[model samples]
Target: MKAFDIAIVGAGIFGLSVAKAAHDRGMRVALIEKDTVANGASKGLLGALMPHIPSQWNDKKQFQFDALRTLSEEIAALEEATGVSTGYRRVGRLMPLYTQDKLDHALHRQDESQTRWRTAETGFSFNVVKETPFKDWPAANTAPLGYIWDTLAARANPRLVSAALKAYLEPRITLLEHTKFDRFDEDAGLVHLGDGSTLMAENLVLSAGYEGFDLIKDLTNQSIGSGVKGQSLALKLELPVELPVIYDEGIYVIAHENGTVAVGSTSERDWSHKETEEPTLQAMLDKAIQFCPVLEGAPIIDRWAGIRPKCRKRDPLVGLIPGHKRLWVATGGFKISYGIAHRIAQALMNQIDATSGTQIHLPETFTCAYHFA
Candidate 1:
């Protein structure tokens, strides 16, 4: 059995980020994934790094806001170190206001949360626009709706970002792909692989997304996560679009590199993790064309679906398991995984270090017992 100081299950962005953080701390780390790297939601994401500013006014939304605020610089550093363009673009976000009442509501929310929750240093900007600027877009539909431009939000190619993180951590960490974790022996501090091999580790971290819940169900005696399926599509547009990421009426259209525009996504909680449906594809296309008419003639290049891990309280479960000292969890990041994974991983590393008396003081929400109870 190969022993390590830390073993992380799942090679998604969350797991990879954790591995990198642990490795940075001079801990021997092993990252295990059931499939190829980034094959899960980390690969299928639209890579919108939009912070939930409206939700940040309340105490409940503090964790996500803080995580995203911290991840801004962390992601840039990671990209710089890896020399791999994560396709990170701080192109801002345009959220169209359909009605005056909606605009008023958004303004009120922004005003309420601006002081404490807004990330000004990271270029979080917002303003209402009255006109439809795009020549190919429908004037009748978009002209009436005022839009809010959020400068802090950004987008990246999720696949490339995950791949870059993996490559960056390759020399420092052990990556095991296509290897399933059967379970773990808490007392022995051992992780059992599907090949009937056991790997020893003093500490275990489960960043396995929705699958992590099942692996620990027998020992934990509770459901910690569930899958929330999302459907997305990519269209190769005829003309290049320099439009900021547009969010209107729950649908979003983001400009991608190489003259391609990515439009998504449908939040369907009842759907399974099966192949994409024609109706879903057409529905997304209809909305994309409605938002940006330049996509009318664009060819459909790729369409896919991914399952986001939704927790019971719709927040992530970080920190160590309540009763288990060596076992930890860092999953259940519903839709904000790509945006906040790096920061969450950093916080988890701090928590582990704190347990070992190497550091102290993490936010109360990040502690595992907060959700475990």
Candidate 2:
């Protein structure tokens, strides 16, 4: 039995983020995963790190903005430390402004975004541009209107980020693959594994994506979160300029640094969305073609699908699971998981460190206490 200070189940971005945060703080951690790393929503090809509209300022939006602002530097530092590229960049985003009413609303947000988003460290700006921001950018000839260009928006290679975390913490943490965390004997401070192996840990953290809901249901008999199916596609197309992510309707046209344009994502709440091609996906692709005419003849290299977790409140669910002392959960980021997973991990660790604990100032809406209440 390995004695660890913190034992985290699930190696999604959330779990990996916790492991990195804990390991960096000199805590002995056990990273447990049922499958290989980054197999969940964390590894999705479309890494749209775009910020909120910056209007109607709320704690959750502020938290996400701060995370998005600092993420580039944070990932850069990690890349320098481990020599792994997260493919992160603050390239900004462009959204088609169709009607004048929509343009007026976005312009209003532009002012609001500037007031809050602008700071010393990060100079994120919003503007309504007439001409295309970049050559070969998706002007979407169909909609002969202007675009909203937001400088705060960024993108990251989710797969690379996961790999970087694994590499950075490889030497410091105990990573268990094909290992299942079956049950938690909270009072005994023991974790029962599937292979009949038990681990003694001072505290436990659950950062499992959608599966975390099931784990919590089994342990507490409560359905705290559910999974939302998201489907995306990767296209093999070389672009001349590095364009910002083009978002229109539900389609996201992302031109990655690797010269492959990633387009996609249909949100399906009811039925299962599989990797197999279907009409819904085709409709999205058709809409995408209308949005980005250049991608009309692009090759569809891969289709990726995953279920992002959604808590009751629809924000991130973090903090102690109800009625449990040694157990804690950090999940349900849904679409914004990648944007705020690092901060969620940090906040969870701060919460777990009750005795001589470090101060973690998180939004009230993101805490589990509020969610369960």
Candidate 3:
């Protein structure tokens, strides 16, 4: 039996980030993944780090604002230390305004939450185009409306980011891939594997996404989350468009460094992993081409599907398991996993340290036990 100070299940961005944080603190860490690292939702992510305005987020806005701000610097540091270009670009986001009312509302929100909300003219630049130059563009219907440009929002390569984290933590952490957790012996603090092997750890952290809830339900008797399937595709474009990330007419188009544009996504609640409907793909394609008519001639390169762990509250659940002394969870991030993973991992480490009588403080919302039925 291999013993470790901490055992993390799931090698997605969340799990890898947590492992990296623990390893940085000189804690012996073991990360187990049922599949390859970043093979789950993290791999399928479009890697957009666009933060919602605090005014639009209502109560939970502050946390997101702070997390995004923190991640911007954290990712830069990670990129510097790891020497891996995660394709992080602060190119800003272009959100087109459809109607006068919508523009008024956006301006009002920006004015009301000027301290929290960033808009064009205030560090960011946006313009209202009378006509979109590209053919088959959707901006025709919503033409003459200006766009809200946010300078703080950025984008990154999800696969590169996940790979960089894994590489940086490799020397200090034990990564066990293609292994599934069968169950755990609560009394002994041991996790039994599918191969009839058991590993001991002083603390266990479940960042296993949707598959986590059922695995530990017998011990915790709690349903922490569910999965939301998202389908996205990549297209190879002929012309290189220097557009930042464009969110025109409810569709997202991000230009990648490889001269390929990635467009997504459909948020379907009831969908299976093996399911890939043409309509869904077409819908995304239509929206993408509508947003950028240059994509009309772009060759379709790749398409994929991924499941995002959508919690009951649509927020990440990170804390100690109820009625369990040595178990904790960091799951149900939905789409914010890529952007918020690092900060969430830091917070989880803080919880583990606080449990071990170490003084580390985290926000209450991040470390609270979420109620799931």
Which predicted model would earn the best lDDT?
A: 2
Best by TM-score: 2
lDDT of 3 by residue, 126-213 (tens): 3334444343333455445766656667788889899889778877788989998776666797988878888999898988878776
Better of 1 and 2 by lDDT: 2
* Residue 334, model 3, lDDT: 82
Candidate 2 lDDT over residue span 106-203, tens digit each? 88987887678864446778878876767647744644668888888888878988999999888889999889888878888898999998999988
Better of 2 and 3 by TM-score: 2
Q: What clash pairs does model 3 have?
A: 138-290
lDDT of 1 at 333: 75
Each candidate: RMSD to true structure? 2.6, 1.8, 3.4
How many clashes (backbone atoms < 3 Å, residues ≥3 apart in a chain or on different chains) does model 1 have? 0
Looking at candidate 1, what is the lDDT of residue 189?
83
lDDT of 1 by residue, 1-373 (tens): 7889899999888999889889888899999999988787776747777767564455445556666666667778888888887877776777767787978876876665456554465446555557645543433466466667566677888888898898798877888999988877878988899999889998999988777777657667887677777888887764443556777777777777756677778777787555788788788889768767777878888887887787877777788887788888899877778887876787788877755323433555555677677
Q: How well does model 3 score by local distance difference test?
A: 0.74
Kindly provide the TM-score of model 2 when superposed on the true structure, using C-alpha atoms.
0.95
TM-score of each: 0.91, 0.95, 0.89
TM-score of 1: 0.91
